[model samples]
Target chain A: MLERSHIQSTGFRNVGPVGERTGFELRLRQANYRGTRLSLIEGVTITVDGVLYPAAHNLVRIGSRVYTPAELDAATETRLAVGEYMTVIVPRPGGLAPGVHWVESAIGYRHPYFPPAHQSAVARDARHATIVMA
Target chain B: MTGFRYGVSLYSYTDDLGTVMTLDDAFDHVADTGATGLEILGETSVPLYPEPPAAWLDHWFAQLERYQLEPTNFACWVDTRIQLDRKLTVAEGAEQIALDLRLAHRLGFKFIRPKFGVIDYNLTPDPIWEGAVERNLDLAQALGIIILPEIHAPTPIHHPVTEGYIAFIERTGTRNFGLMLDTGIFQDRPLTAWGGGDIEAIRKDAPDMVNGIKVPVEHLDDIIRYVPFIQAKFHHVDEDLHDHQIPWERIVPRLKALGYAGYLSSEYEGVRDPWVAIEQVRRQHALIRRLEAEWEAQHA
Candidate 1:
């Protein structure tokens, strides 16, 4: 079972070689009530310790495959199911000091039913998660 | 007296499902409520939806038999706007309906509620809904399923969207199609906690929905004949068995008076804390059943 909160602590770690980290990645349980196709998901934005990582710089990894924001717009058949989790990769040169940090995630989901301007309704979640490894 | 069929939609336990609850747990709760029907969203409830594994299929029937419950409605969606840039072609939309109808039939469901993509804040469905549904009418009849599009909150019954649906039924004269009324329209109070979506955006987009649409219960008299199922959409129900948002008191009696014997499937959209929905749904069942019994006893 996934954590109750949308932002999960299980997969929170730095990517690339441990000491020379390229960035950090955090797992987020599917934000919508129902499974949504990848294209329907606009992008995922992350903020850690008040430092913002916009959607444009984040690459979403669902299962083993990773997708860019533009790729998500074209990947119509690929769906992110409920109970499933996606990883948001944020590029930070030094990652973070090994400790607990306040983190937040916002998934911009475009519902076809919603009018044009409000299509991307943000499902936002914030929590403090521990990064055991530096 | 014909009584309303009791049921619970798995929607009540949306956030809880993967966190603290499972499909088996949901069945136990619904059965303990003495609900005879079980409703589920096709995409959310079925693993690897559209093509659930064979083993899961077997487990599904097993659960139904063990719980002594019947499948009532399979909720689905038509992403009319399938992508960020383009809309679903008519063929793609029809295939979507056909796929859901077959799956609903296979799962022993009597109704398939297709939530079509809307074009506006009023929830006016995309134009493709008509052509797509029209193409699938024969298949629905053969499968013994009713295709329902919900008259949800932010959209009243007398509006053009609903009138357009009624007009489609009249023009096509199809028994396979009808309206599914969500009780949220009758909600007269403000919601303190909304689990369904981003609350601030909803407040900005549809204030009427946030405050309450308060569709007069009497309007049920006009459309009761076309409505075959109801999503008892509610927010909060306290220990005293009082719903804070939806007006079930007025809604139930009118349904009873209209002789509506369809399913009142609970859709509890409220505070999303774990295990909250489980208790909330129980309170709703208790609240509605008491109201129903009161109505029946008064008439008797």
Candidate 2:
């Protein structure tokens, strides 16, 4: 099982004090609990408040590899080593008079045992972050 | 000798994980019921799994020593879909399994319940599950941990997945892999007081939700050897210590007749009210103890 843990909004900074644009990074560790490595070819999805942002669309930095939307979509299958973790940075766009916000992220992919065209299932984790728009 | 050993799953008191009860409290509760074994849900019980620090591991073992509890199973997940876009390769899946195996071994557990990725809500195995299991068979043997796929409710023992698992075991001749039969399947009816929904709606849905696709009690004989433990899944226990849904009277004796020696871990997947759940577990243990004595006498 690829378990998602330690999900937190690490750093938040304001682009403008009037809240023209807000930026934050959601830091999480995706740990592979299965006896094997996994690939993130399908891309990840991050939902802030109720807005859905695909990893392919957002900038994601794992290790030293920074993936653009087009690159994440076109990247080959890179396996995540078992028991090893990939620290993921999901760049979030923010516009808020915020007291608290909820973030949910999930990666949807088919199991190797699943047949072709079968609906993929998701490994999901969520966290609540109290944000102060200072 | 009676073929069954009694135990309680810490999952029964999950409502108290970080609140009312700590892991120490859970061990005390299990010991109070005269159960020597404990089944721990790795995700909830272990704080930072696969890499918990030495201090945490020491505390875990200390609790076990204090309560004289044996770790029976470390229930975990095998997520093939950790990535958003692609499935893990066979080797990758094996790596995840090996990781859990190492953790389970380190924690002194002999059994690991790995929930393989499912295709349906009923937890139908993905077609490649055999390959996943096959790939890890060696590691499982080396780690000395048996991987038991939970045959939970709504998924009958006769389901194609169960059959496939049985075939896989036969084909591979591996002793490190087995089945963990959940007693939820023997539930003959739906729970009346299950976390208040529309009583009528629950009543209608309960049958299909709990017992609709159960493995018949008779089928237990055919698969008894493969089963190392039974998750005695219960929702409610009455004043008389009787479960309204599962037919324990019939099932317990059958297990004895088959000479099945395994832990019957009380897995209370009921409401989150801890005190009531504790009482319910106590009553369930009473029922199991009574049945064990009765069955032993009859056979003797």
Candidate 3:
């Protein structure tokens, strides 16, 4: 008999009845602007389950329907017309967490709250000075 | 005996008082907050540099009276880097202490809260420490004011420095020396947030590090017997207010039961909006007033 390890595959979104009567909040971030890094995801059209979620304050939203950009299968159309919005229907199979899990930017890397630890530059300078003195 | 009047320390509103508040504005603000007194910072609030003129002193007292707020204290610090060594020499520390006393006397402050250098500075409480205390008390007594050494963070009540502080006062046998116990020593943050500043950093390296800092709320019973002034410190939360991380529900009652008539200042540190923060101080003030009334109702 071989011992087996149970592996749980959890995805980007978690969809279920909100616990404690409070719905979970999720952020829809635009990571790809065709290699052009810019704030305000300008001229980006977004939708959640065919409902129009306008990009305002660089964020688009559907009431209680949390969706991320990764969840949207991009169409050949690169840009929406001026004052035009995109319409994409919710995938029949996709929902929230337990419904879908989208890949995120490399985790455990470059988290602003976790700054990289470095040796003191002053201490290094002091050591060099001492070496020069010697 | 008139109970020690409530006051606001300028350090309590470092954001507003440091920038927007002038001495006159501070008096007005403290009075508006219903505080009976004010504690002005030496450099920031008092005309310490180039000496405070007699006319300036007179104007300060007039402003204080106009707002009906007494000058309770002047918080004084010594720039030890200029005077160096872990502790200041008795003569050196005394010079600064005497300045605090003179300023207090001039501005009509009955008390002076002096920061006894940084926590690490007085770790072992050496002879220099004793010398500083002796000299400060002497200067304060001569000036007819009480010099209070504040028991703040990085030093617990039971720390040797605190015990040595009490011993120094008792040994000197001067009525002009005392303690200012800041309630922040008893505060508790989430274990994950202890020193990491992350509020989410769980240290697998050291299990006990989570509860690394303790402020001696249990020893508050011992320390309160000697408390002359209290930094009635209120942050956004009270959980981080003490060494044992004392919840005010327990600590406040204990202080009241002890008949602590010391000044309880409104030290609000909620970093939102000025109006909102002031409102917070008011709410806490109301809570304290109710607590004091309840205590009096029973004890009186």
Candidate 4:
């Protein structure tokens, strides 16, 4: 019966190679609803250093952590140095489906959409951003 | 009518693979029940976690041809624990994605069925949940596959993955990403809780039920375009009455109207009896085939 549960944690690490690739992890319980298995939360989004991950890829890892939106690392946020930790959380191991005691972790892998050599690279603006069901 | 083939998802026989049947045996069983297709769950057909040798690829394909069964799609995964909590790196996860995609391609499957965020009792994404999904999808696209996020219950259609997908496409503009619609979300009632009520009673009682979960019935016009494949998610079957609450009559027609000639695999998730449940899956497939014919007749 628990579809969307919230989770919070601190002192998570930025595991990415660069500060841009770091992420976090969270753990939570699973619940069932109406013959259907449900998880605590949905998907996690990552922002390395300061750059918000345009998509969920290189974003959150499912199953390793306990809750959704789990895992936050420095690499996922704006230009941060290595060893700088961030926060993250995902629903559970089953991906929003009930019946388990698994955790979900999200890690941010710094995106160099701009080549490393391009020192004065201006981060290309996201064409458009939205939050709608596909 | 294209005959609109029917199939049984391999997930049902998760526990007893040796006793129930091999992938080929299951396909044979489906054909015996007069079904034409087969839906392979990744766990049963593919190798386990940690990974398996690439040689297994040919073995699976051989099974598909020997059975004369068309692979509907793959039920791949990226849940909370494996992705979020485990020490596995995103690059490692990408490798898994690539491996699964190759498996799907080798088996002639067009889509991958993966569920959304993991199930934490707390019900929420990891603090950095969004980043993980984005990276997974990125790797999925590289493999020339589509990441079809399943819309199952508890994590209704209104969830972030459902919405984030829209954002993903808009940002990346890739057709390789879409929704894998599961019919169970449309049910109007809670059949049972975790092991307390009568499973059989609920299955029988909700023959025409609809939980009215957030599946976006009203947004079909908008959502249908995003759906590349659909799962005829069924639990039990009434071989005598020839009915189930999955709403195939309503859904099949709508799918056909949208020219959705993709996979319509059957997912049986009841605990009554695994073997009997499989037969019910075949029966359900037969019913779907008949409905497909009728709809085609009217349209043609």
Sorted by lDDT (best first), the order is 1, 2, 3, 4
Residues A1-134, candidate 2: write the lDDT tens digits. Answer: 21224354544233333544544555544422222223433556777788787766555555577666456545533443332334444544545446677778776544432323333435566777655664
> Residue-wise lDDT of candidate 1 within A1-134, one digit each (tens)?
99989999899998878889889999999978888889999889999999999999999999899999999989987888888899999999978778999999999998887766577788999999988888
**Per-residue lDDT of B1-300 in model 2, one digit per residue for the tens?**
845788898778754555456667778889999998988867667765557789999998998899988899998766655545555577776776778788889999989988776666556765556777788889889888899988876678888778878888999999999999988878777665553222444344344554435457989988888998889988887899787778888888888888888899998766655467688899998988799789899778
Tell me the spans in candidate 1 whose CA falls farther than 4 Å from its real position: none
What are the per-residue Cα lDDT tens digits for candidate 1 across B32-121? 989999999998988888898999999999999999999999999998887778999889999999999999999999999998888887
Lowest lDDT 10-residue stretch of candidate 2 chain B: B195-204
TM-score order of candidates, best first? 1, 2, 3, 4
Better of 1 and 4 by DockQ: 1
**Per-prediction DockQ:** 0.75, 0.10, 0.01, 0.02
Which lDDT tens digits does candidate 4 get at residues B1-300? 444445666665432243334556666676565655677765445543224366766676676677677777777544334322343345554555566677676667767765333334213333333454556565566666776766555445666656766776778777777877777776553443212123443344332222325354544556777877777776545756344445666766776776777666676665533366566666777777777888888888
Candidate lDDT scores, in order, read 0.92, 0.69, 0.49, 0.48
Lowest lDDT 10-mer window, candidate 4 chain B? B193-202
Any runs in candidate 4 off by more than 4 Å, and if so which?
A1-134, B1-5, B33-37, B47-57, B82-95, B106-108, B119-142, B158-160, B189-218, B242-244
TM-score for chain A of every candidate model?
0.97, 0.60, 0.23, 0.23
Which residue runs of candidate 2 sit more than 4 Å off their true CA positions? A1-134, B192-207
Looking at every candidate separately, what fraction of the true A–B Cα contacts under 8 Å does it contain? 0.71, 0.08, 0.00, 0.00
Candidate 3 residue-wise lDDT, B1-300, digit = tens: 123357777655543432234456656666886888787666555543327677887897788778888777777654232211223466776676677678678778888875543334223332444566576666677777877777755457888778977887777788888788876566555242231122223344333334434564567788787787887765553322232232566666777767678788756544423334455555566566666666666666
Report, to 2 decimal places, the DockQ of model 2: 0.10
User: Which candidate would rank higher by DockQ, 2 or 3?
Assistant: 2
> Model 1 chain B: which ten-residue window has the lowest total lDDT?
B198-207
